[model samples]
Target: MGFLGAPVVGVDELVDRIDPRPVLESRTIHEGYVFDLVSETADLGEAGTVRREFLRHPGAVAILALDDEERLVVVQQYRHPVGAFDWEIPAGLLDVAGEPPQLAAARELGEEADLRAEQWDVLVDYWTTPGGNDEAIRVFLARGLSPVPEAERHEREDEELGMPTVWATLDNVQEAVLSGRLHNPSTCIGVLAACAARDRGWATLRPADAPWPEHPRRR
Candidate 1:
């Protein structure tokens, strides 16, 4: 099955079972928080079948928080891999198989930013790094936040992996990205999606929009 002229490729059978050799591979073993060792063993043209082992994960989510005051809630924390702080949107992984992307988005907001949204409108779903891995990211826009005291939330090692919570206007976000303050790729994409949705008058970020799942226009 091909979407266009390119044939849809799928791993249908096992040929060779060998641990991926780092030297023979083109990608590094560890990237950021992910172990990204990719197998470079696909057929080119006249070569025999080649196969390699790789790790697979469920996928993840990122949330763009917008408020009525025109503020964007971001997080700043040091990423051990880069040895630098990243200002990014609230995001997390979906550990449970078959877990809904929307639920993961809502739960990540509570864990990472301590803010509850009345409504969440999904903006986009995409792959963060599509070269070798299949991990997809679901981006959501959360509005009508119920302010939970920042002190009440406990940071998990993964959540605290880089982002810790900072509030900035859209202008500030743009400036930070320009000044080397924000470096997370997924966050940047989410911010742009949020901005686009906001322009269409689709986001609700203040408490006035509270208890959002109850709203008729939210979905």
Candidate 2:
């Protein structure tokens, strides 16, 4: 073993504690919200120690805003968990196994933003609270939008609760982060990445919605 308990494994070793035991388990007790406790188990001696824990659903996806005019997209909704409705971006969990993150992004844009992108690029993929959950958000940068009729879109059970899409400049979003208005990491990172990707000119995709009037700068 290496340090305290770190193993001297090869650089190619992809998994930690190859024999990791399922420490505990559970199941989803509700809906519309994220996290469905899947199962649980126990870990024995040697490779590690004993611990209690629960399994969880894999995760979902989040997409930053796009104005179809090379601008950023943001959405607003009342997050009871956060206790206030604020402008954020489009995001949701994947319900189907083997579903593509890009497809999910397209669907969310249509359902939440009433827009669709002509092109979608993989932005970044990361786990959210891996220490306690298996949830991961695969973010994508969408460009080139086309509006889908509201009738064709299936509003999420909670969307009727009022999730609406708003668009803004990336610089504005960066400012919101600094001022403490935006705290969602997925939104922050996705916007930052999209900003950089814009300069790098990843790829141009068509947009579904007509560009909205620019909101006055946040003082």
Candidate 3:
């Protein structure tokens, strides 16, 4: 928590103070290809019962692949909802049931960047738009990268077919983040986390397989 500022309380005290609201009822409002819209009624005690709607996402993993030159691998693709070409790290949904998140990260790395990494670390985990979506994303820092063998390369399709892949220096990426040029949530978070981890001499990173008990997909 050094980079995040002072801690308010110890883990035990924080856990003891938690009084989670109980969900009285929940139902899927719409079933989509990647996610389902859910409406939930919860007992908020003093606030009384309330109803809310949100997307129940399957979760996702993003990879921040760094080459020996310290350039970060990125992709530019058009996102329909945003109606713009966004720069983002390699990422994909964790839709494969029972598959480990780290493995999903590796798959995205290969599919999006055509790269494989020998070293990996957990950079950060975050919920994208927590107020309306349960889309949790775990970002990984990958080093010692090499191109994926041509024999096992993944075929790009749809939006990925013409997407351009590029490498940017860490400093440039950080500048983009601060200058508001980068709007993709996972990419921005990953870049900032990687910079912090590097500044702290890489002590902030966790093992690639570290337990993520808070990730909703795991539960």
Candidate with best TM-score? 3
Candidate 3 lDDT over 40-139, as tens digits, reads 9989999899999999999999999998787999999999998999999999999998899999999999999999999999999888887898788899
Candidate 2 TM-score over all chains jointly: 0.69
lDDT of 1 by residue, 1-219 (tens): 576676666676523332333333344444444434455555534555455545444567788877888787887767777887777788877775656667878788887888888877776666665445556676777779987677876567853844557788876786767676667977777776666667877553333222322111122
Which pairs in model 3 have colliding backbones?
none
**C-alpha lDDT of candidate 1 relative to the true structure:** 0.66
> lDDT of all predictions, in order shown?
0.66, 0.64, 0.91
Writing each residue's lDDT as its tens digit, candidate 2 over 84-176 gives 776767877677665655677777777777777776666766667756766666677776777777688765666334556567778788788
Identify the candidate with maximal lDDT: 3
- The residue ranges of model 2 lying beyond 4 angstroms of the native Cα positions read 1-34, 38-47, 150-160, 199-219
Model 1: number of backbone collisions: 6
Estimate the TM-score of every prediction: 0.64, 0.69, 0.91
